[model samples]
Target: MNWPAEAAAGCSCAAAVAASFGAPAFRLLSAGLALLLAVAVIPVCAVAVRAENWRANVYNEGLPSHLVAVDKNRQTFLFFEKKSPLKLKYSFPCVTGQLAGDKQELNDLRTPEGIYFVEYKIASGLDFREYGGIAYTLNYPNPVDRLRGKTGHGIWIHSKGFGLVPTRGCVAIGLKEIDMVGPRLTPGTAVVLAERLDESKVPQPDNGTARELRRLMHAWSNAWAARSRKMFDYYDPDSYSKATESFAAFRQNKERLFKSLAFIKIYNREIHALEGPGYWVTWAEQFYTASNLSTEGVRRLYWQRGQDKKFRIVGMEWTPRDVGMRADFQKGRLVAAALPPPATDASAEAPLPPRLDMPEAPGETAASGIPAVPAAVAQAEKLLAVSNPLVPRRAPAPPPAEINWGGRPGMETDREETPPAAKMPSAPETPPVLPEPAPPATPQAPEAPEESMAPEALSLTPETRAALEQAVQGWNTAFAARSLADMAALYDRERYNRLPGVPRGQSYNSVQRDLERRFRAPWLTLISRAPSLELQGTLAVSRCEQLVVAPDGAEQGVRTLWWQREADGNFRIVGSQFKPEELGLAAHYLEDVSNAVSADLEAWRKAWEGGRLDDYMSFYAPDAVQQGRWGAKNIRRQKESLWARTRPTLVQLSGLRLLMDKRGIRADMNQVYADSTGHSDRGTKTLMLRFDGRNWRIQREDWVAQTPQPVGGSPAAPHQNTQRAMP
Candidate 1:
């Protein structure tokens, strides 16, 4: 790929967008990968504000924090919060020495460092190959990393991934950290990691690193502060100044954003180095409108020094640092921070499995020649259109990191197809009682130093065997449901396992607490289909497809997952993946657009509600694609799509699962879309939605019509609507 040209195109697109609003020139500098290059075209004219939707928030408050790293050399690192007089120690299960690295490739593991915080948290299968729970990636390798001549790769964290052992070079940690920090860490949290952890390396809150990050905040704030398009340093040269057409658009938008807030300010900030040279600093944008309406989730950020040497922010993420800020400006306080999309590791020539836990590469196809999809698979490809979010997906996080499950049968970790979000049919005549199966005859966690597991004893009596079998099945089903009650009922309550991917001091129980809290609410919905269950004695795997939705109509699909029957006879999700749709381009676009909208989810929502369709459409490429039952086409297809959804159908939407990226949004709707006659479908539809540089629209779909067919359709009477029957 032409990196320079792509970079230039991004710079121009961003500059042009900023110019469109008659705002100062904002240019996209060298940072991130082609994925980052793909979103320069998102329009900033019509801001859509969706306040009801929730964002995962991460922050820092002079707390004790440290970064740990493990490399191919079997070397590990723990960088503590040096500024704090208190130096605390953290211990974690280790999994180092994956790749057979040469001296020249010391930095190939691609660990990163920057002022970043955890965007979101989820039990990502990619994080743990052996025992997996949660995983979080550091917002690393900021633009500065590239400019500083640091070019390993990013997404440095510790987890037992979904595949076999191999990392260019990175550190591994427990699942506990991912859950504890991923969601709480927001944009602007400092994430810095180096080979050394001495006091000298401590970033004194006012160090140059801090200044660069604050400069970013100042730039964005100033950008918002100004209405004239000049008085800025960034932006493409040719389109440096706004032409007449662009000037008009900029003035309209600039006026509203600048004048609307009754009160606004930076709420909170944090700093950290997630890995090597990758630092991040997050700032919360808090506001209270004069009308008594208020917002606390928006987070503005600057990712300085990615792979780039200068401090150019790759993008801003959504966060909730100011959540506590009250709606009443008269008496306000902070709540929680907003959450941003999960981040993805910038990949290069290094070989990686589809999931982090899987040991073997599916097949070593050259990364340069990654294959494209064929026409028959267009439906599947559309599902793939969702971007790879920065946080653990709404449900399934990243794939489990590769682990050595000790070449055992019945013990193999399953691939992540989707989260078990769909409701299963009530027991259908209770299937025949099957005999107990063996536990794949092998352990599935190789990288886990073996201490987590105790000595095993085989049990073999017909009655005892049957009892164990039934118990395992029951537990499996509960996990499949992902129900708060069912999950809580099965919690060990004691002797919990630290799985992998979380921060050092956090507890796994906190993850359970968060999941329970989230599941208790109706804001997020899972969008998975029926699960196909398997048994390998005490070990079991469930492969399923699902849709996860947010309060608004946003959705994401989940794929494969594996779970084990705990000693308490309850089931817990052990490993999982975020790519249940397997649709090409979905992961790519999800990350790009989610990153875009997350920075301003509420703004985008308001624009949509106000019917700023043209301005709304600017968030995507002019050449954007689309696919759905209404059929597929270019930008024009929206006409048909809008007519179909808004037409007199009775789809009752409870919560929408949204997966996003820099380009736009992907949503899984748990729609009870009623028939014009009023029957509800209670299932889900997978929509590959996106912004085409103007408005949020569908670029593709793998939507199963799960909408139920009403009773008594005429054999051949004049058709009312010809949509497929609900599954």
Candidate 2:
């Protein structure tokens, strides 16, 4: 109590003394008061410093050497590289998902906070501006997330438009930032996201679990190299669920490959193990060779401890290395530091089985007069027989009385009853030529040699049909195998032609190049079904439904191939046509025009909602017509006024239909608009766009309003005065 009272008394005395004194006396009193304040503040500052919190500076000590740390609280992405003095290489402002908080369930719309890695870089030209200029994919819902029961996919790090808007559970930065950093980030680069990042801490890999995991991986590799089927015991066959084939099927397939190849070798490097919830993930570079073929790629294995206290592979994924990564590895710029030693157990050190000998010629026989087929070859044949049935040679069945054209063949029909076949009109009977037959029997008149019957139309024999089917199947298999040379061999290079929407003159060379480019992707597959073939002389036409699955997406369409039989009795594709089942286009002109118009409309909506005034107006032609209450003359001014007073939050277009002619293309669609003030409107929108040999521009736009109706109501009348036209 004495300190507080003494301070108060001294302040009051000093104030009174200063007021009552002259200028010289006041200056002396002020100096004395300043000295007194400094004396009082020193003790208080020392006490505050002693009690201050120091917990924020205690950073995690396990951060990796080279990594990206994202601080959600600060909205910054800091790039760190381990050097003599650890320092941030760069700092970039970043945006997260729409919702703030850690992601949990599917569609939570919240960014996840954890350590992850760049899965891969998306190819250019597949995404829209909404995804910024390009994107780098992230392995969201990774093993850890999945173990925690999280779901959803397609989370990425991308760029945004002009503004740093929210995302759908993805991290986004500016376009410039992506361009500057995209190339530097590669697969396996670490990305750590936290509410706050502490630069003082460095993360280190969990070496204990990593060592155990590496031992398990080496044992598995040793077993493979030794061609030991006992390796299957190491895999938790019952626990594994990600593979497309069952354990038995996988074992059978592997056994076949092992027997077929002369030798198998495996080299592993860049091994990394990440600890997840109740499991561990090990990823590494794998170089494999069988016979004369060699391939290098990245392989990931998810390992989980079983009841027996042994770690077993629960999941696996393999992907070919990216071109850039492969180049770097070849140049020794991205080589691994070191790989763990191979397994030393007696079983793992066992020698590989010898390759099977080729079967002898058909006429060659053993001493016992039986065909000289190796036992291994005989066993492989038996396995193949069980797995794949041989194409049987049999007589072709008669064509159906009436072919069903209502739906695609090989697809189930929803109709309750099958339609009856059309009845063929009875062939008219001709009167018997009895007298002519008797005259012909008189043999004195040498009978004219019977005219050879012309080959019947659509009469393909079973052998020929089987050959055609094999050709088509071969094409499909080649595509699935991603063999560009095999695919090119099936195509008629001399007379290759494609229908509209595809590039013209797609010769064998061009096709091969295209296939090669496509094969570069991590996922590419083509499947065909319900093939119908028609033969005419040496030419054949086959139609089938083709489903193409790629990294970007999947498309199912109808494809027609024209094949010409060569002198060597091989059928080759000469021409082909493909039409997407989603869009029912009447002609080629409408496909591109329709797509362009739809894209333009979407861009306009995006621009308007983003508040980009100049971009919103750029879609319109200079002389575009607009009709409203103020007529067409003040259309721009009216829009400007509306934009100034209100902001558009959402615009959705549905039921879009297009009609194109020589002049332009017309689009009719239903529109729904919502604004920041909670006002909403639904109406029909029509836009007319004209193409000037280069670009398509909006010539006219009309918006018609429909009165809101009660639920289950029949119809609503349009408001006559609500029509607004825009350029």
Candidate 3:
């Protein structure tokens, strides 16, 4: 009401009443009404004031002011304000993976539960239908995820224009909601992903596990700075081996750096920790400087609490971005140089890097340990004033016709095309960049313990095999004849250096000198039979039974020679391993046997390409299986029938990788097949070969069909093989 106007109107009405009736009677009635009005207004005004205070207090005391939290179980995405006086700025309905559980391997449709950070925002060049014109990628497989041997890449918080459809290990929300929250998710912003989140259950400031993790991180960092071997002690060697590179390889690399650099400086900044389902993630912005290399990046260390109630680092993830470390180092060096020398003879030790001082929990009161309100439910009375609708329940459908040329089938392709001259990212590079995961596989039967490939069935062609035999004989003759030129011509110094297991302090020059000394011995003689040769790509391995005669005595042994093809297209001896027969046992030359199996694989490919049906059939064992047809006879019958109709014109194999396990030698390679009918297809070919006394025969063959596309194409985006467990 307008108080002045109402008062004037009331006075006019009172005057009129007084004039019409008796003055005393009108005055009494007016006073009585005014008293009644005052009595009603007093409590209303008081209630209004109290309600405002309550709203303000609720905001200040309740909620976490700054954080992004995702609850997979509830399908809620919450964003809080960065400023103090706790408030939940945005709450939106979201959808996670259709399946539940933590992601483990590639293509596993389950969101990983962990703490991560927004690495970057993808605003364009994405499928509008799939990504809702914007997406933010989270750094999954973060250092901790990698340490756990978790595989996959490309987990993102995105929006889909069609609907909030459940994702394949991604978090999705509405378009409007994402647009509002996207700006706040800057690079390095903390993101906590959990199966379920409850603000009321937030841990207190002094979380024991988090503190222990921080201590462990400091100890490891200190050891690294000191260049001490104790650094390895912090790592779970067995887990580290499976997660990233082999423990030996990692140690060797670190040791080499430790010996090479005179000093190392590491400063960690903005350290924070977040507890996940079963692990804790501790991350910091790290600045590293060595003799020649300087880099700065965000490093996340994943720790698992053990049975002994101790935390140990299991894996680590690094996000490299320039943080001006080089400039900082130069500036610091200049300042230090300007200072005068110490007066004492002995220089003072440098101060250690600052220890982690975690911030206390926000809004703790004396009377109550918890905040004024649980962040997730601050305004329970008006919770859905602005809320996203639930995602429609529907199965994923393929997008409409689009020119997704290079991307995997049914997925979006990049809008921007690169020039022909630009280099394309290959399959090997996907593991580090593309977020993906794997699935459980059936266990395979173990093979014989002493399974080794025979020399005769090596991958070498007949001509190459014959040449290798002659080369071995010539090497022996050259040694006996004291022909230095002949012996030198057969050796490849560079290739020899690559040969593993070479004795320490021995070099190509030393071996040559030793050979020269033996050449001068008048009674020195070398006799050797034809050598078994295996060729994989340009590298070959040859094993020979040899007898050496000297003035003092005679000796017999097996000589294993490593050969490499030189620029001149000749196979030259790169390295040699010798074991004496006096031990009454054969040399355990497993490496040699593996190489021979690879050679046989190449021969098998050659036979297929040449349409040598009999030879190709012979490569398979008597009980071999191909494409579900059991027994070699059945497999051969199918192949013969197919070949009669359309002969293979080209059968090319590349990227051959062989793994020798207890079951047999598993050979995986990319194969391209073309036939007389002009049909051409490509796929990954996996052949399981078992050594059968004299040859490595294929026991089982499997082919996974793939639509061959130019690398870096959209089609190849989601098609990536699992990264090798060992580096």
Candidate 4:
């Protein structure tokens, strides 16, 4: 309105107001408007606030954020990792490893525990190519875990929506958990897991009445060792009087423990103090046995320091080995005598209990009803078979017969491939012992077909590109701020497709709701850094490590990317790979701060190629399921039922790659494994891999047999194979 004042330089403040009024047309301009427009158009935070019943911030407060359940058995494998600031209830379903065939053990099937991170994220699994709409991968066995010598690797916490069901060892939650819990997980989300749910705590209806003291002991013992779910009715909610009443639960747990028929005698009972009915209960389990051999020793139980801490059983120092059990039969006799006679025969009756079976001699197989093999060495046995290759496979080999090929299917062929020059040939040179052909004459690798490969984009010298590195950091910051559509606009439309903003119905309300769901996962931290970007002329590859922190205040890392370029660029990201572990320079970088790849390459290849897949896969979780290049990228998923499925006759394991720190060891390895599957159609495959702490597994398995390309020019990116819960 005041033209003179607005135009004059003398009235500077008035000119500022005029400039604000003249700002861009589409959107209003002001300090507050900028902040509101930044995160996303959808009001995600508000909706989330309304939905969340509880509030906790794991990062800032450093407490248990939330409980995580990997319910596998009856959908009950509740492995809890607390995420602080959890405002709403989060639940989802998942697929599990294959159920082991025959009589397998607990260590077989791999439902992982400890800590992990969401290392990579996708709008879809490469298995479905662009058809699938969103998934995330977790860094399961990290580098910090070397000391304990754990095995198995390449696990994911992805979407069930990625497909219906089935996964090697990945947890497939509902899309809600994907949107809600995954994104907030920075690379450091602590994942504390139990092998399965603790059966001892589950309450059941009262089966019968208890009268005498001995009956109570048996019931308690059954509850303690077996982790019986039937005893849940006994846990008193009133017992938990405070914010934490774990101590009360511990007391009830003890009573149920002592009630099992297997329970011996309670030599001592000491409760220093009591908060309500619960106090720290420290006790012992009293027996150890061998086939015909018998011995007894004490296994002490350690109580939590206070009533609030989780209950743990551990033996204390100075507690005599004899205290756990008597060295002779006298102690057992005495314990039996001390138990007052049960009130009735029904009270003393014991159910048929489960026990460990001993191995019998080979010829004794018929007597035990189980087959056995001889222990002595036989002349035909091949030794020193394929272990693992610490280096590449292309390295020159020694003579054929000189190397041990193990029980691999094509062992004879592999041995035949060895250089003849190193071998003592039976016949004289018929044609000629010719000198090696010149290097140039040998065909190397196939050239990249133009149809499959993307062209280079963003013409810039390394010097100018350096500036973009800094700019990328800022761009990521904006991306983190919920600029979903804005970030997509920066991508070259020619090469990529952006996920549509969240819809209002079954999906979500807007991009903010979608991003907000992703934001809940701790692994989606600080998305503003410039990941490694490679521009191959017209084809650009931008890669970055996903830094995640666990609920335990520990950090885990993942690898991911965005592939695109300018509007005019013809090259595009038609294909993508879901590689979660930080391999190569990325792994080295983990050690730079602090940890860990696949199972097959490390387990089978290292063992078979070198000979240890049999013993190696033995360590694989019985329901050990593996998905890789065994067949097709997306089609080849293998679930090992037992030693039967893997059929490892004999193999060697070597070149253990382990990571060490003050806490313990995080193991990574390269091994060669070969075995006889009793079939001519079979051949051993090589694998390179890492350890996730539970079993020796195959991580990255690029087969000796090249994965076949689809009829079309390019190879279709594979989707992750999934396994369903058996019970």
For model 4 the TM-score comes to 0.20
The TM-scores, one per candidate, come to 0.32, 0.37, 0.41, 0.20
Task: Kindly list the per-residue Cα lDDT of model 2 for residues 1-727, writing each as its tens digit.
Answer: 0001111112233334434433322444543763465457664432110011111111222233456767665677777654533457778998765544456666645577665677545433334556865676676655445554566676788887665765667888888777666655655566766556666553342334565576566567767766678668777775553321234435644665566555555556655664443456676667543342233446667787788777887656543332233233233233223333323432432322212112223453555543343344333333212122211111111100101111111111110111111111111122122111111111121111144232222335666666777777777777766778788889866556632222355676766787798777654545455477765444566677665655444555787777765567787887767777522111122322344455566677778767677887777777775432223335566678777877777776543444432245455455667777677765556565665434556767655443343234222233222322221
Model 3: CA > 4 A from native: 1-66, 81-87, 104-108, 143-152, 201-203, 306-308, 324-329, 333-727
- What lDDT is reached at residue 684 by model 1? 33
* Residue-level lDDT for 594 in candidate 3: 38
Sort all candidates by TM-score, best to worst.
3, 2, 1, 4
lDDT of each: 0.34, 0.51, 0.52, 0.30
RMSD in Å for all candidates: 29.3, 28.7, 29.5, 30.6
lDDT of 3 by residue, 290-336 (tens): 44233455677767755665566666655444334434433332111
Clashes (N, CA, C under 3 Å) per candidate: 223, 5, 28, 145
Candidate 4 clashes: the total is 145
Candidate 2: segments with Cα more than 4 A from true spot? 1-66, 69-76, 82-88, 100-106, 113-116, 122-130, 141-150, 188-199, 205-207, 242-245, 322-727
Residue 285 local lDDT, model 1: 41
